[model samples]
Structures are given as structure tokens and as C-alpha cells.
Target chain A: MVKKTSQRISVASLDDLVNVAGASQEQEQQYRYHICICVAAGCISQNSDAVRDALIAEVEARGLEDEVQVKGVGCMGLCAAGPLVRVDPDGIVYQSVTVDDVPAILDSLENGPVEKLILPQDIPFFERQQKIVLENCGIIDPEAITEYIAAGGYLALHKALTEMTPSEVIDVVTRSGLRGRGGGGYPAGLKWVTVAKAESETKYVICNADEGDPGAFMDRSVLESDPHRVIEGMAIAGYAVGANKGYIYVRAEYPLAVERLELAIKQARWAGILGNGVFSTTFDFAIEVRLGAGAFVCGEETALIASIEGRRGVPRPRPPYPADYGLWGQPTLINNVETFANVAPIIRNGSDWFAEIGTEKSKGTKVFALAGQIVNTGLIEVPMGITLREIVFDIGGGLPDGRNYKAVQTGGPSGGCVPEQFLDMPVDYESLREVGSFMGSGGMIVMDDSSSMVEVARYFMEFSMTESCGKCIPCRTGTRQMYDLLSKVVAGEASQSELNLLVELGDLLQNTCLCGLGKAAPNPVVSTMQYFEDEYLERLVDDNGSADEPAGES
Target chain B: MPAQATAETSAADKRWKLVEATMRRNGYRPDALIETLHTVQGVFGYIDREALKFVAERLPVSPSQIFGVVTFYHYFQMKPQGRHTCSVCTGTACHIKGSKALLDDIEAHYDLKDGQTTPDDKVSLLTVRCIGACGLAPAAVFDGEVEGSVTPDLLHERLDNWLAEEDEGNGEEN
Candidate 1:
């Protein structure tokens, strides 16, 4: 009787936790200077903790402990210049802060600013970036529920629940021109409407945090920096899509991200944003975290659903999409982290406000985990219609050490490489697709002059081939064969016939592959062939097989 | 304590008997000891060489198979590790960008090697896969910290502090 009573109490508490919403507006306004140190997975590995310690020591040493509160925050997106530390309420952003600079920063804290460490707002990198998704990053302590509330975190969910209907929310999202940031560019609102109208007794909302794109850390950053926002977004999604329960399918490799998210879920439940009747409304919602076992293919929706169900991570043919039948044969709505992150802002600020920022086709800002040879590499959230040149040159601060830009590989292995000629192209979903690249989960790897195009193509193909789930013949066989041809080309062993065969195979795989993974696997090879065919031709061996032997080969 | 001892004894006795039985069944050979050990480890998560040798004494396969298989996968370990293991990426990209300096700082400060554990068995330092953020090169993984673009000065200060806190925790436990 005692155990049963306790269980009932626990269930009631859980229900109360989920239903609670609306961050209490009452917060202390006593000014305390915040020093946010980037402790995202990327910056932490770089010893950002030391930077934090140094800042704290400096503050204590100067006896400014009362005046300032030093804290560890999530990624500030300028990953190339980590460990990033930002001083507020001045909003003086500092990049690549080392232990040696701590004393100087503290000394300047009293009088003015550390001019040397200050990230000038006028700089192209900061000027060009129109941060929306990353607005809270470097501004608030990620773990603090109150800080998130103070920043209007749960207001969108509150508004959606109290003011709008499910169809109304979908209509706003659809009218705002938001598409899936998961590289598919599918209409997000339309997808949600389909799941809502599917007449299923049970439905699921899954946040695709299993970001497997190589060189991409955008989703991970969001999870680490502001987990509450994602929870709020997922809650909003749950309310809109009629999903009683939600699952965040994150990779096991992201332990920090997972830890923070788990904490956020607990906090959200406590705040009454996640569990039973959210925001005092009749709508019910809950979320569970399903960890992926480090399978790259699990990023695909069907495979992700399979992995969630405790099955081997693999993709299946579409027709019955996850919206129609998913997660234990129930209708499901799956959206990437970035896509979900956009929900609250759109709801709070209105659709027209969100739509005014980018191109007609693509609305709002897109976050890119800017990586590779580019300078100022990190997480960057920029307006959608911003040109590739602005992202690569202005926001990215161009290639490191004045190296000439070769090509920018966007959308990971599945996305194509845009050559220097297309640098001026506006980086929206449509514009990127026009040049054979899709804005896949926002992984932009900028290559310099030293980066061999042929080698880059082979590298991406190798990644796709290894990650292919072998669900369909075209992808399973086609990717491996293309990888072999690219490898031969890299080794200067390929004849003209092999090159033609590679192109032929690329086209075939694009058309015939069962899912998105296989369909887009040949993107790297296709784009490279389109732009750098000469590089492939140059690698071709002559009639004599002796030329096929790579340099230094026995 | 007595129950634990009995369980251990029974486990050891059972494993020994199984090894002997399997060896007798398979026609074991002396040279095939390591191979048999690897096969046993593959089925299980770890290797008990006595069981391995017992299997080897019966099987036709060479012991080299066991050694080869043990060394093949990154997951398999020859010995148990400390509670917390830190792996620093020293790939070509990471190496070029001062990862060597950071590694050296960690080694000198902690008195560790590529796969060596601390004297107290609190922390172990190892080298591993690229950690995949080549853009933020010079990366390290503390348990699973996934820090990127690390430098020697920062590594020394942070690692020393972490180690000191760990030592304090150890003292409390004792």
C-alpha cells in the first residue's frame, strides 16, 4: 500500500512537472557583471575550463568577486577563435582567450575594456552574421532556468497554448516559409499538418539531435548552450502536432549534450513546461531521450526511428514516411534541432517578423557549424539569403593565413561542393540546390588552395560509403563502387572509362537510391566533376600501368 | 565478504573447467594459445589467459589469432583502466597545430604515457581517433569532453586543477 501510494504520488508529480509552463517574470535586477566562458564540447576540449579558472582567479585577486560572476556558457559559434569568452552586460566578445590574457582583462575591467581582446562589432565576421537561433548563447548561463525565463524562453509555448490552435501554429510556420534544416528542405509546417491530420490515435514528436554530418556541431552546440530552448521548442511542437510523448534521438558520443539535455528536461518538468497539461492548458506532452549507438546512418528519419525502437540502425524505403507510420507503427513528426529551435521565435515575434529577414523562398537565419580552412571558424547563425561569399569571406573572415579559397563543401558528405565561381550565390535552400548542393544540417567546410579537389571528393565519398545502411541495392552497391573509382582516381590508377563510369554511377544512385542518404551520397562526386573535372583528368594514368602507381609506391 | 569470495572461487573454477573442456573438445595446440584467448574474449568482454591457455592446449589454431584480434579493435583493452580515461587526439591535423605540446604538458604534469594510468588509478591518458573537429584542430577528449584547439599553457593549468580535485576526492574515499 505504501509503495503503491508513493508510485501514485510520483506519477502525479511527473504530470504536474510536464504541464507547468510560463517562466515567472519576477527576477532580481541587481546588476552583476557576467563573464560567459565558452564551455561547449569544442571549446572545453581546448581547455576553456582553464580560461574560466583564470578569469575567476583574476576577479578574486582584484576583489571584484561581488561585482562580477564568472560562469561557463555554451558555444558562441566562433569556434575557430575558442576558448571564446564574452563579458556582459557590455557585450564585449573576446575570442581565443588564453590564461595569459586573464590578468589584463581583469585590470581593464575596472577602468574601461580590454581593447586587445575586444571582438569589434564592426568586424565583418560579427556584422554579417544575423544571429537568431544563437541569440541566447554567450548571453546567459545555459543551466539556469530562471535566466532562460528572463530571456522570454517559454513565452512562445505559453502564447501557442493559450492563444492559438494546432492548425493556427502550422499555418504560421507554413506561411513563414520555414523548411527542414535537416538538408531535405521539406516544408516543416506542412509536415506537421500532415501528422496532425493523420487521424492516428497516437503520435510522436522526435527531435533529430543525432547530427552525424562530419565537421558539424551546430545541433550539439544548441543542446549544450541552451537546452531549455530546445525543450521549449519540442514542447511547442508536441502541443502543435498532438504528440503526447516526444523523443530526442541524440548520439551517445555527445555525452555533454545529453547530460545538459537531461538536466533541462528535469527542469522543464519542474517548471511545468514538459509533462501533463503545459501552460495550464488541456494539451498534454512529455519527452524521452533515446541515445543512438554511434551509427552515422541513424541520422536518417526511418533509421533513427528504428534505432529508437531498439533495433539495428537502418533506413527503409519511403511512401509510408514517418509521418504516416513511425515509432512502433504510430504517426510521428521528426524535426532537426535547428528547425525546432526556430519555433519559439516564430511564435513569439510573429510570422511576418521572422519572414522579413531572409529571401522569399527561405525565411529566417540558418546556423552553420563553420569548419575547415576558414578563419573565424565556429557556429554562425546568418540570414538565409546571405551570399556564400559573405559567409566564407565576411562572416568566416576568409581562409586562415591569407590562403586562397578553393571550394566550400556545404551539407557534409551528402551536400555538394560549391566552387569559387559560385561564391556570389545566395545561400538559401533553392540557391544551394541550383548549384547541386543542399543546405544539409549546416556543416560548411571551406577548403583552401592546398586542399586537393579530387582528394576532397574521395574523402566525402568514403564517409558516405562507410555510413550507407545497405537497405537498397543502388545505394549499398553504388556508393562503394563510386568510392573505389574515386580512390583509384586519387591514386592516379583510373582510366578514362572509370571516370565515365563514376559519373554514370553518380547519376544512377541519385535517381534510384531508396532514401535521402543514398540519393545524396554522390553529391560530392557530382559537384567535383562539374567544377573540377580537370583535376580528375589530371589524375588519370596513361596507357602504361606504371603511371597508375602512386608516388613512393613499391 | 565470504559470499563474494565463494562467488569468485566458483566463477574461476567454472571458467577453468570450461576452458579445459573446450580445449579437449577442439584438440588444442600450444602455439594457438593467444588465438583461443581472443576468441574467448570476443564472446566475453575481457580475457582470462588461463582459460585462454586451456583452450589453446586443445585447439588447432595459433595463439597469435587471440593477440591479433585483441589488438585489432579500438574497444578491446588488454587491462582494466582507471575510472576516468582522457584521450588526446594526435592525428596529422591535430599534431600540426600544437597537439604535441598539449600532450607533452599532460604527460609531464600527470606522469602519464599513451596508455598509462596514474599511480592512484584515478585518471588514464590515451591517444585516440581524430575527434572529428579538424577545423578546431589540436583537440583532446577527457572522458568525453571533446575539447578543441587546445594549447599547452591551457592544458597544464586545467589538468593540474582537475587532478588536484580528483586527489582530494580520493583522500575522502580512503
Candidate 2:
């Protein structure tokens, strides 16, 4: 059983932090086995909590409580095969486990591996990938601060606070080739340096956990699995930028993530890690979570800041970015959850180690939430410059039902479609952008041949149209016009000139729109036209007194 | 005039106390408007005209500003929900997995469109953008429990079971 943490334990020095980790580890040594079950939202939806209960009951009935510790951990990544049960030291995973299989799992813990229930660890889904941000995930109980500390959490904060100066901390980060993981691919250290250099009395750090993409759950999973990592990362960022306050603008849709974050923030505060006088140093920092009401446009930085300030979430012009003036007119530094999650590890290890991982520019691994069509439709983190074919075929296990892969839609509505020709191409920020798709938070939705290319383009256009905040007329009206044109083409009514008009509208939106949402609104349509113009041509009306071409093979 | 619980206000209403507690926890500021509205919707299932006026009185924001903030975000619901809600996920994964067809089937069976409730107020059908539950494609949330890999038959059965249970209770709980 996980020990109930004391109400308040103030840490006056780095040695106190070390002792907490040491004590937790020493207490854990008594148990012979650690039975970890994935209790992330995806697994919880499948009743993993019930499985955990059943396993605990079985352990109690068999008098194995002393030998085995049943604990609820974070997402195991292979959410497709959840509620997953993992046995530590043995390195075995049980997939799709239920209450019925709990007794068998207990028996196998005493005996050997369960034949049918085992999730093979040798598969490319688990292998051929890296885990940096998710190192503590599925291993540590997110609610238990002791487990986190035992796993070497807060050491980075300790190092930053006690040893390194703020400038030195920024220097290490600047040398680390870490780019913003929220799809912008901006250098994170550069952002920190700007905020640090900005003349301000109060600089703030905000972790943009408002993952507004329809299918993306990487950040949600991270927040749910290891909220402390994000917390620690944010606290480090606050220390580096000479800021004492941070805010995580997460969506209200993720109730579980919010709940976990609140609990983790409380534990960190009670343990004297987050609140005033952290690690006995004069450096004091705190974090507050601002819930984002359901508005897709709020994913934009300006709109996100506006929403946090209790107003309509509308994006403003960027000459004076959030670095100069953000979050109540303070010089604010904003990075996504994934970008911050990389900070603790990059600081713990040297920046040169991180710089060696990915391609020259885009360093470190990316957490991609693979959804739709793929067999392994959950979360996966792969090193940068990995091939799309390796991801779709080897890691993703290809499309289910032996279906032919058509194209994969990356980056959500703001991103474009990637056809089969780019399958062999390396997947990095630059390569994805060159292929007409930019990583908008890494939600890869694979498409089979059954999905219509024209309809797919229309679907994204409709999403963009509905989500536009209507602040700028070019975005507000242009998206509606593009959506209308796509709809007409889908309905098989649009003439050749209307098709040309659709192309014109795509160009117009890309150039004149105010925010990132509007500028990249026509990406799906423009990209589909680039790769699959035949699909659109088939949808067009014939001028030779002939009826509309029988659309497609569908 | 200060926004307070007047003589006509429901003093005995315990739900109002929960809303008040959230507002007080947030320090009665204008920024607390969204958080306050969330608590109202959480406790009462939806925000109403009275609640909006009540929140505006406590927080340092005008009623129009509160209304605009509420209306700007889709999470806030102005109208009262039905007895039960069945939320369908129309996300990319769920959509590709034929969630639309499942939604179409539910609409046809209930003779109601998306965001509509049955005339009897038995159940409400709404399409959620995405709950980030793509692992469980073709997902739906009945009440609050998320059921993944949901088919039309499975969805209908759950909704039918809820209706039947309520009918058996005969408004005893209501």
C-alpha cells in the first residue's frame, strides 16, 4: 500500500529533499513486488480502477499484501491494450485486464507469466522508441509525492535553486536544442532568455495545457500520468526566468487531469517545494491553474491570456508578444506542457546529451497521440527525424482489418494531410512543414482508403469555420466562404470557377488572417489539393453537358 | 446595490451555498467569474438567469460581461438539461470509426436532433467535440461514465435502461 503522506513537511535544504527520496525508497524495499495498473483516463474509462480493486482484494485473500503492493499508476502508453497491469522487476505487462483476470494475475505473480494475457514487450510499439518525458509515468503513483521524490523528482529544482545562478540555468537551457513541443517548434531557451532579459518587476511562466486539438491527448495523458513533471518543469522555468508565479491554462474537459494537478500542486506545496521559500533559498515560486472554457481559439497564446483574465478569448497582434506583455501586462514566458516536461531531464542531464538525440535543430523526443485507423491507437513518443512509415507501420502496427492506408492527418485542423509519397520522409518540424503539414501538438489521425480525401478536407474546413473566434473579418468571413466552397464541392454542385475560387480563398486566408488559427485555417484544403487533386476534380461538375462524375470508387 | 441573498432569494437552498463557497474561495474577483460559473453548472447542472445575476452581484463584473463570458465558452450551458444526458464524441478518431452514423441512428430513434432533449424530458442527446478519449473510438458519455467502442445497439440499450429505471422509480427520486 502507498503510504499516506503527512499533511505538511517543510523542506529547508536540498538534503531534506534527498532524505524524503531516500526514506520513500527504503520503505519501498520491504515489498517484493510492485503491481502497477494504469489509472489514466483512457484506462479508467475501461474500468481499470475496478481491476485494481479486484487485484487488491485477491492479494488480501491470498495473504500476499506483504509480498505484493498494488498501486495505481499513470498511462502505460499502449492505451489500446488497457487496463494494463505491469509487474516490476519481471518486466511483464498484462493487456486488457479485467476483474475476472485479477485472480489469475495474482496466481501468475506467484508462479510464472500468464500466457494469453501477456502484452509482449518485444514489439516495435514498445521498442524502437524512447521515453524521456514519460520516464516516471506508469511507474510512480501520481498522487504520491514520495514515489516521485524516490524516482529522483525535484532534484532539478534543488540543483537550480542551490547551485546554479539564474543566468547559468538559462545558459544550459539555451545550449540544449529543445524546441517548443506545442507545434510552433520555437526554441524554448530563446523564449526563457527573452523573458529573463525583459525589464520587468514580475515575470510569469504559463504552461499552456489547453490542448484544444480534437484528438490530441498527449498533454492530457502527461498531466494525468505525471503532473509533477510538468509542475517541476514549470517551477524550474519560473526560477530561470526570475519569475515567482506560474499558471497552467488547461481545458475543463479534462476533469481527471485537473483533479490530479490540483492534488499534485497541493502535495508539492505542503511538502514546501512549490510555495514560498522553496528549498530554503530566498527564491519563492507558486503555480495556479486557470481552467479554459471550451473555446478552440483559446489555444492561441493571446486568446489564452485573454481567457485567463476573465474576458472573451480573442487573439491580438503579436509585435509585443507574451514575452514583453502577458498575463495582466507582466513579461510572461509561455511554453506547452511537453516543452516544460523536457526541462527537468535536460537540466538533470547535460544539454549536449539532449542535443545528440534528434535532428540538428529539433532536439529531444515528441509525444504523438496516435488516433484513428492505427491498430495501436494511443500515445507514443519517438525521437525526432523518425520515418512516418516506421511510425505508421512498425510502431502503430498499421491500420486495423488489413485496410489500405490512404493518408495520415497530422497537427489537427490547423495542419495538412500527409499522403503516401511522404511516408518514407523523416518526421521533424522542418520536414513536416515542407510536406504542407506542421505539427500542431502531435495528434496523428491516420486515414484508410475508405475515407474520402475531398470529404476529409471539407471536414477540417468545417471544424476551422466553427472554431473561428470572429475577431478578424478575414478569418471570420474567409473561413465561412472556404467552408461553403468545400461544402459545395462535397455536394457535387461547384463549377470549375468555384474550385478556383476555393483555391483563391485558401491563399487569401493564409495571407490576411490575423491569428495562427485563421492563417492555417485553409491548410487541410490546400494540402489535399496538392497531393490529391484528383479527388477534388472528380467532385467537380462537367461542362460537356454531362452529369457530375460519379464522385469516387466509394 | 450590493449583490446579496435578499429575502426573496432561496436562503434554504444548499446548492447556492456551494456556489458561494467557490466564489469566496476565489476571492470575489472578476477573474473568478469563469470559475464561479463552472461551480454553478457543476452544482445546478446548468447556469440560469438568476444564477448569472447572482454571480454578477458578487463578482466585480457587470451582468453583460458575465453573460458574454458564459456565452463565449461552449462549456457553459444557459438552459437546464434534461433528466439524463447522452454525450456522443464527434472527434477525429470517433468520427472515422462511424460515430456520425451512430449519432444519426440515435437522432432517428429519439426523433430529436443534436443538443435536443426528448419531449418527455426523459433524455438529452448532445454531440461533444472530443473528450480526448480516442483510444475508445465511437465513444459516448451516458450521465458521466464514458463508454468506449460504443455501437448503436449498446448506446440505445444504456439509454433505454436509464429510462426504464426512472420510470420504475416513478419520479420518487425526482
Which residue pairs does candidate 2 place in steric collision?
none
DockQ of 1: 0.13
Q: Residue A219 of candidate 1: its Cα lDDT? A: 87
Where does model 2 sit among the CAPRI classes?
medium
Q: Estimate each model's TM-score.
A: 0.78, 0.97
Candidate 1 Cα outliers beyond 4 Å, as residue runs? A1-28, A57-63, A543-554, B1-135, B138-147, B150-174
CAPRI quality band, candidate 1? incorrect
As a whole number from 0 to 100, the lDDT of residue A110 in candidate 1 is 77
On the 0 to 100 scale, the lDDT of residue A89 in model 1 is 74
- DockQ score, prediction 2: 0.80
